[model samples]
Target: MVALRGVTRTVRLPDDQELHILRGVDLTVNSGDHTAVVGRSGCGKSTLLNLLGLLDVPTGGELTFLGTPVQHLRDSARARLRGEAVGFVFQQFNLLPGRSALDNVMTPLLYAGGKQFWRRREIAMDILDRVGLAHRARTMPTMLSGGEQQRVAIARALVRRPRLILADEPTGALDVDTGQTVMALLDTVATESGAALITITHDVNVAALARACYRLETGVLSAAAIPTGANA
Candidate 1:
């Protein structure tokens, strides 16, 4: 579970211009909850995710994960906590060009469990297998279709059994059909793992699959009630 209280992040441009990304945003995601955040482009969805993932500290207010006040943690402690608890998916996929699918999934585990390279590889392969990519485990990203590559990315995110999976526009790069497949894969993984999954999307159809949906407008987040089994 994750909670943000009056969280705000601002940046000052070189010319004394101030950009406020997140303005006192307060939200909570419960365990096993699939939540969708929909907003127009440049509305701070990804910035909120980065704050949730502990990749960046908030400029003001507080963020808590499982009741822990993470904003004040040391850099090393934050990194360790992030690796142990958070998984990430991005619009770009962010897969390594030289690594095979199996290798890419295993990358996270290397930082975990004492960094024994081969141990992570075995665990990664198992995750890849669970994602139905065992046969394509040896294939490179360039050789795989968009959906396949995204599945591999999902496998990589799940390799560590993270408690929270932050997906930022995960289906943005694929066509409609392919995007559906990718969303299905994400839903299946979160359900199987019982992890709190938060997906940031602009598409209403994609947002409907989530158990809860919220819309961001004018620096505020409001929950939206979507019909059951309508777009999932």
Candidate 2:
């Protein structure tokens, strides 16, 4: 569902030096696959996620989705592609403070399909139920707990039924038990929807849930073989 070839992103520092965030990164993800990107801060993990989501363009190399070269698309075209093909979950829930959980989750559907607008509420409710947040549907983000808010975010990400899911530090704000619950919910949603999932996390336990895992360090991405005792 996603591929990157020799992708490199560079930024100029005030010191007149170039900082290479991603260096010759080559990666691919297929339908029904789950990938975990493990790295410390400033290791280009989020940069890689942004590239996959088409939120940012790489300075060099090719990124393709469903066989289309994403780098060649126009800005409006890229936005349309993102709305149709991608969903994103972040460490911060990013819900509107005044909106109820149901309303927040339905926001994605508004940009998804014009004909599906009226049905967005129902779809949002279903996703909330799937994420075990049906009881909090009418609650506002401030009134909900951290885990609850993240669950609402997950519901929003799933409401569109996009082909791919990009999650960056999704469980970072929650406690251990809550993080585990949220991760499991994410895993279940991706499996049920048949959408390829890519998660960037610093936690080793969280990374173990994916079918394939990789670590980013020093401008390189390396794959790891799964062991029999990986965390579920």
Candidate 3:
């Protein structure tokens, strides 16, 4: 679980201007919960995702992950925690060039060590199957269609069975039907594993699937009413 209180992320531009990306954002995500954040472009959705995933530290306020204050942890400790608990699904799929679907999914386990490292291939294959990509395990990203590539990315993200799943516009690059199927797949898999799912998207249809919803604009976050299954 992760919690943010009065969190602010400010970036110093090259010209020495301070650009505030997140301002007074307060949110708490519990285990097994499904949450969605809807925002327009340039509204800090990605910034919020980065902070939640431990890719960046906030400029002010507090962020706690699994009851530990992120600010107090050493850089090494924070990274270890992130690798062990966080899974990210990007809009672009972010598959490594030249790697087969199976290889891409196995990349995460290479850092896992012990039994996980030794069983990386087996584990990756299972996840690929879970995403219905088992048959395409040997296929390269360029050879796969957009939907197939996204499925591969999903398989990679879930291979670790992370406790928190952060999906940033996961279906943004897919066609409507493909997006719907992929989003449903991601939600189902994350829920089955009891991982808290936080989807960042601008699509109301996407937001409708979540148990709770929020609209983020101009660096501020607030609860928004979204009828469950409304746009599904």
Top model number, lDDT: 3
lDDT for every model?
0.86, 0.88, 0.93
Q: What is the lDDT of residue 229 in candidate 3?
A: 53
Ranking by TM-score: 3, 2, 1
In candidate 1, stretches whose alpha carbon ends up further than 4 angstroms from where it belongs are: 114-118, 227-232
Candidate 3 TM-score, C-alpha based: 0.96
Candidates 1 and 2: which is better by lDDT? 2
Using lDDT as the yardstick, the better of models 2 and 3 is: 3
| Per-residue lDDT of 120 in model 2 | 88
Q: Write the per-residue lDDT of candidate 1 for residues 119-160, one digit (tens) a residue.
A: 887788788888889999889999999889889989988888
lDDT of 3: 0.93
For candidate 1, the clash count comes to: 0
Q: In candidate 3, what are the lDDT values of residues 1-232, reduced to their tens digit?
A: 8999999999999999999999999999999999999999999998999999998888999999999999999999999999999999999999998999999999999999799999999999999999998999999999999999999998988898999999999888998789889988999999899999999999877888889999999999999997555344
Worst 10 residues of 2 by lDDT: 223-232
What number of clashing residue pairs does each candidate have, in the order they appear? 0, 0, 0
Global fold similarity of model 1 (TM-score): 0.93
